[model samples]
Target: MGNPVQRPLPDIEDPLYQAHFQGLKDQQLRVQQCDACGQLQWPPRDLCKQCHGDRFHWPVMPDQAVVYTYSVVYRAPHPWFKEHLPYAIVVAELENGLRLLGNAFGADVEKIQCGVRVKAHFQHDEDSGVCFLRWVPTTS
Candidate 1:
């Protein structure tokens, strides 16, 4: 059978963050930034976290980051992720001033190291209509 460990992705319906989810579906990573300070914010907020400014805009990501920390899941506590055991759950520090949390594929647990370069990819769930952000090692 197809990957049994696959799980439904998020189908966020709220208009405030619909565009954020759509960006992932389009294979373009985006995050909200303060128009004033240019600080990148995660989870796409309506107002800047730093200055509480309501002038926020979505900016495309450069897709370049380095792993800051990670955990190798040898066993998933839930049935949905069992097949993907031993996956690398990584927190990547983006160059544009953000740390994104996602799964890292195509790398072994022993090979995972802080400062490893990575780029973004997407995984979609047809049933639930959710898109997930995944990462792959960057050659550069």
Candidate 2:
């Protein structure tokens, strides 16, 4: 069996982001932080550029967040997104000043409101063989 050509998946071979994916697989949101400086970083890196520390810190993301910004993806850049057209991608700001970019869970794409409360959640697409760290708006 092989992955579909239209199916998009991250290149998990890179160790820098491996822990991030592992954290998602475990249903936990984890961001890399500098073990030396205690500063969080994104997109993953080999060394903490802040202090050049080789160690990494994985902390569970807070349950509360607010939509810092968002966009409605009516046009998909990838073929896989075409099937799920009109999605909402949000930059959720956690209580700790960390921001996580994730797809807002649910079909009502128009319901995304800036400054709206949200929480982290995991979604697994069994058919596409993929997992996601999604953010769902909290019930008002």
Candidate 1 per-residue C-alpha lDDT over 1-140 given as tens digits, one digit per residue, 9 for 90 to 100: 77655574555787667767888888888778788988778866777888888876777887778888888788787787776777888888898658888896554655778989988888877776778888777676
Pairs with steric clashes in candidate 2: none
How many clashes (backbone atoms < 3 Å, residues ≥3 apart in a chain or on different chains) does model 2 have? 0
Identify the leading candidate in terms of TM-score.
2
> lDDT per residue, candidate 2, 42-84, as tens digits?
7668888788888998887776799999988888899778877
Candidate 2 error regions (>4 Å)? 1-5, 127-129
Candidate 1 colliding pairs, count: 0
- Which pairs clash (backbone N, Cα, C closer than 3 Å) in model 1? none
Query: Looking at candidate 2, what is the lDDT of residue 26?
Result: 82
Every model's TM-score: 0.82, 0.85
Per-residue lDDT, model 2, residue 43, is 61
TM-score of 2: 0.85
For candidate 1, give the lDDT: 0.78
